[model samples]
Target: MPAINQQSEPVIEIRELVTYYGERKILDGINLTVESGEIMVVMGGSGSGKSTLLRHLLSLNRPAAGNIRLFGQEVNKLSSRALHQMRQRIGVSFQGGALFNSLNVEENVAFPLREHTRLDDNTIRIMARMKLEVVNLAGFEKLMPSQLSGGMIKRAALARAIVMDPKLLFFDEPSAGLDPVVSADLDELILRLRDAMGVTIVVVTHELESAFRIADRITVLDKGKILITGTTQEVKESDNPRVQNLLNRRTEDIPVNADEYLQRLTDDLAGL
Candidate 1:
């Protein structure tokens, strides 16, 4: 990936972002910035709050604390109508593709246009096909999602995501459940999308190879806290033990306090 202009205002800015589910803290004081036309990959183990962070970025959940600014607007401060308008500038490609099983590929891609714009049917069809062509799925639009292969489904979902020509694109595990060849192809497609469309992209994944392949910069999170954010090489050379453990696939030996453990068990039994 090429270097982006550092002086440009970031398309996505997060500061001290905190989220909670009941009494459990899912995201703890996160701070991140994503520059225009850059591909930022966020990676972490399960329960590391990566998913929660995505939810906050998408404005699907209100953070317990801190601010998320998208295209210079604070998401949490927006009214429902304003929020919907803001969302029009953003696109999400879900991990499972999330296409309507009953709808064919063309219909799925046209859904956004029909809901958001009053474009005529012919215009919508042409625009949707153009987007599908961009994703290399031009002729497959007539097929249902179930009739396509895994790779095709992902490509179709990506077509729908980009059909609106959003300024920011969010991808969840683009390479998951695909073979190495298909995964590499998807990675290349991601790079091409950034280069051709100049859309800022945020990818959430745990796959190291995929992250390293597509990311201009990478942010690693551990236990609800960010461990490091840097170029891929910088992250690979990080001296942090947790980062090393994650990259090397080593398990951390977390020592337990016997008294605290026993007391917690006792408390559970007493409550029961």
Candidate 2:
């Protein structure tokens, strides 16, 4: 397939992004930028708030204080209609593929077009099949989600994501359940999509090897704060101990308050 050949632009811009779930801060003062055609990976350990960060970026959760602009328009201030219009310019490939179990691959891929466009059924089918071809799943378009292999499911979801020909794409845990070989293949596919479609890609994954292989830059988060946003080599050679601990898989020593732990386990329900 031929490339989209678009000019460079800033697709995602965030400044001082702060998020909270009740009283606990999930993302603290995050500042980030993803230029067109870049593959920026967000990596963190469990509870490091990587998933929370993704949710905010996707506008699923409101942040306590921050500015987020996609395609030069501020997202937080947009109205319902404006937000929907803005979102149509981007696509998301969920962590689990999220293909409808009831729908075949082609229908799942075409669903977005059907909902968003005035196009006829044949046009939607042709477009969906074209994307399927792009993902190398052309012949399997009629197969049900349950019938496809793990990798095929991922590729199919990807085909759906790009069927809209979005300028930005977000992937959540793209390699989460796949084997090493399959994960590597998916990584290459991500790179190809970026190069061929010129889409700015943001991937949220905890897999270190895959992050190193596919990322143009990586943002590492710990305890709801950004450790560093740098190239693969820069991040790999980071001097921050937290970054080193995450990279080396070493355990971090977090001091626990005995009183707080006791309170959590023993809620004073006796008074009630």
Candidate 3:
């Protein structure tokens, strides 16, 4: 089979990346790239280092080894000023929405602008409202985070994340804590954003249904290593046992030994 080259130039690249937390290795020899406008889902079991990889991509955490480049610029080599400039071109919707309790939707959305730019309050408000409209929360700008449903909170956070009109968007488990219908809606929103804004999206998620629905390509991580990287179809057809079990939801058919089970139960009962 011919190799699938998804893009002409990758927007985010990680080559042989390794990460450590004190004495423990968090990510091991990670190599992956996300192309411009591509929805690349990083799928993994809990503690599989998917979030660690995302942090590395955003330069929130430095790699212990190898290289990470964003928009063709080495992340570690960038000066602090340049790094901030690079971050301005990217939007991040963190898990749990991460909105402030004190700030209403509009104020929360405008927070980035207030901190990063010289835009006047009026302009920030307009921009914030525009972004809210994009996420289908146009008239709810005055509502508190507590008043919104889980889905609405996520959408509002998304609006805030994109207020800067970023070229790259990172979503950390966009569908976490959401019901199936709401999760699917968020997937559709991700699709629309990519199509409309030409933004490269990196989603860190383990939800099989959501990942398969939204991802153009997916990378599976296990034991601090990448198990596979392929399109949804390709991954579904993967011959690796672990991949097959994951995609097919096939459980290991372990047969219980009758003698051992009887001995354990009977011994416990006798002692009782």
Candidate 4:
């Protein structure tokens, strides 16, 4: 990734963000900033609210409190039309590729341009092929998603994600199910995307190696709170026990109060 201009405003900003599911808090008072042309990796274990944060950032789920600003506009304050327009400037490559099974690689990549732009079919096909080439999937455009390998599926999906040339790109678990070599290739592609396109990137994953490999800065989340946000070296040298435990993959034995545990069990039974 390239060095960002520190004088400019962040492309993505979250301020004291809070979210919940029923009575259980999912994200609590979170704050972070993603600068232009940077790759920010958000990593945590399951139930640590990393995915929830991504959902909120994508504007799929509204926060219970606080605010999210993308491109200098508060997301929650935008009207439906305005929000849709805002989304046009953003792109997301979902976990599982999220490519339509019915669509071939070319059609899958062209879907966004066809839906979002007024480009003619010939132009859309050309643009889709261009993005496919960027991801190194040029000659396989006619193949169905089912025909592609796991890495190819990911690359094809990435091509679709960048087809519109979004200002901000969100990647969900880009290395979740790949072999080591494939995972590293994906990581390199991510770095290239940020460096070549100068697009701000946010990657949500539990893959520690991938996070460390691609992040310009990393934000580690635990139980809905930010543990630390820093450069890879700073995170590696963190003295905070919780952060260290996460990095070392050490399980912490958290003592539970009997009363609180009983109350939680009683509450669950009552709800059931």
Candidate 5:
């Protein structure tokens, strides 16, 4: 399905993207678009290529075939200088906070400024505090990662991600390790960031509640292909078995041979 509003250039446009890890295809002929200022969620079960697709969006992983355009610029064709400029316009937060253990919260937030701008130490510190404040961690600048709760660490990481005032933000599994209440709060914070910053957000997750709550549109991936792309309402109304399985949270009931099941269990146990 097409997006709700299509008057302007899409913040992100990907077509026929095929990515592979060696010979195994991770993303196959995937197509997607994220409109400016909209919250787009990419969702899937484990090994469904959601993260691979996000890597393309982040310019970390290029497609083996097809193209990715970010804000009208072809990502694959970007020169190093262009790519660097493009990266400055985007912010990314990983599933883990990815904060620097060596630096305090304020210094972690100030890292981008120090690397990318000519700002003095005092100015950078002040700006870092302001960004921390935006994420509700104003007075916690002096705190270390070990001193903060999981949610606080996540928020502090967010403050750092947005310190450069990016136009696009990518989040990988924002609610992965969080409790239900914390996950919901993270969802609300996502919405607030969208409204407050007017930035395009691309979130990769399998968390159904968080996906539905924060998404303006969603793309569901299955077996290296997009099962569907539509609004939350459209997805709910879909009659496709794959989509139904996801929405209804039903596991496959296909009967496995006893030996196969035992071997699978053994494999899992052996891996552990």
Candidate 6:
């Protein structure tokens, strides 16, 4: 869909994106747009290409054919230095925290500032602490990753991501492995970050509850195609069967083709 709101330039835009792993196609002709200050939740089952799309959005992976624009700048055409400069404005909280074990929570949170800026140690420390407070990890800053619970680790990672006060934040699986209460708290935190900081947020998650709770709009991918992109209610009331199956958690029964299976087995046995 052309951005739901085009009154202003989109924060992120993808057009006719096509990607492949070796010869196997992954993302197929995807086109998406994320508006400023809106939370866009990308959801899909396994092998649905949600992660591939995220990689493209982050400029981690390039598409075989298409354009990716961030803040109205073409990502593929940017020079390395320009790309690095653009990346500094974006922050990512990866799945599993991805924190450095050698560092405590505060040090981990300060790493981005330490890398990107010439701020003094005291200023970096204060900035990191403020972000920790925002994520409700204030007193726990002294703790190491090994010493914190799953939720604490997530919050610490979040503090690190926002330490730079980025204009765009990418959160991968924010609710994964978190208990219901902790997950709900994290959802509220995401909402608060957008409202208070005016940052555009893109969350890649399979957690339906978290997606619906935090998303202004959602993009649902199914086998590399978008089933629908709309508000929570529009997705709920979607007439598409694929969308309905995903929403209702209905598993499809695949009827195997014996001829295709035999051919695949024959190819593997022949090492083709």
> Top model by TM-score, which number?
1
Q: List residue ranges in candidate 6 displaced over 4 A.
A: 1-6, 270-272
Provide the lDDT at 91 for model 1.
91
Name model 4 segments beyond 4 Å from true. Answer: 259-272
Clashing residue pairs, candidate 5? none
- What C-alpha lDDT values do all the predictions have? 0.93, 0.91, 0.89, 0.93, 0.90, 0.91
TM-score of model 4 relative to the true fold? 0.95
Candidate 3, residue 92: lDDT: 94
* lDDT against true structure, model 6: 0.91
* lDDT, model 4, position 31: 94
* lDDT per residue as tens, model 6, 1-272: 22334588999999999999999899899989989889999999989999888888899997899999999999999999999999999999988999999999999999999999999999999999999999988898888899999999999999998988899999999999999999999999999998888889999999999999999899999888888999888998999988888888999767899999899778857744
Q: Estimate, for each residue in 1-272, the C-alpha lDDT of model 2 and write its tens digit.
A: 22322465578899999988889988899999887778899999988899998998899988899898898888989999999998888899999999999999999999999999999999999999999988889899789999999999999999989988998899999999999999999999999998788788999999999999999889998989999999899998999999999999999898999999999887987687
Model 1's TM-score against the true structure: 0.96
Candidates ranked, most accurate by lDDT first: 1, 4, 6, 2, 5, 3
Name the weakest run of 10 consecutive residues (lDDT summed) in model 6: 1-10
Q: Cα deviation of 60 in candidate 3 (Å)?
A: 1.5
Evaluated against the true structure, the overall lDDT of model 4 is 0.93
List TM-score per model, in order. 0.96, 0.92, 0.88, 0.95, 0.90, 0.95
Relative to the unseen true structure, what is the C-alpha lDDT of residue 250 in candidate 1, on a scale of 0 to 100?
Answer: 95
RMSD of each: 1.3, 3.0, 5.5, 1.9, 4.2, 2.5
- State the RMSD for candidate 6: 2.5
How high is the lDDT of residue 54 in model 2? Answer: 91
Cα displacement (angstroms), candidate 3, residue 206, comes to: 0.6
Candidate 4 lDDT, 78-123, residue by residue in tens: 9999999988889899999999999999999999889988989899
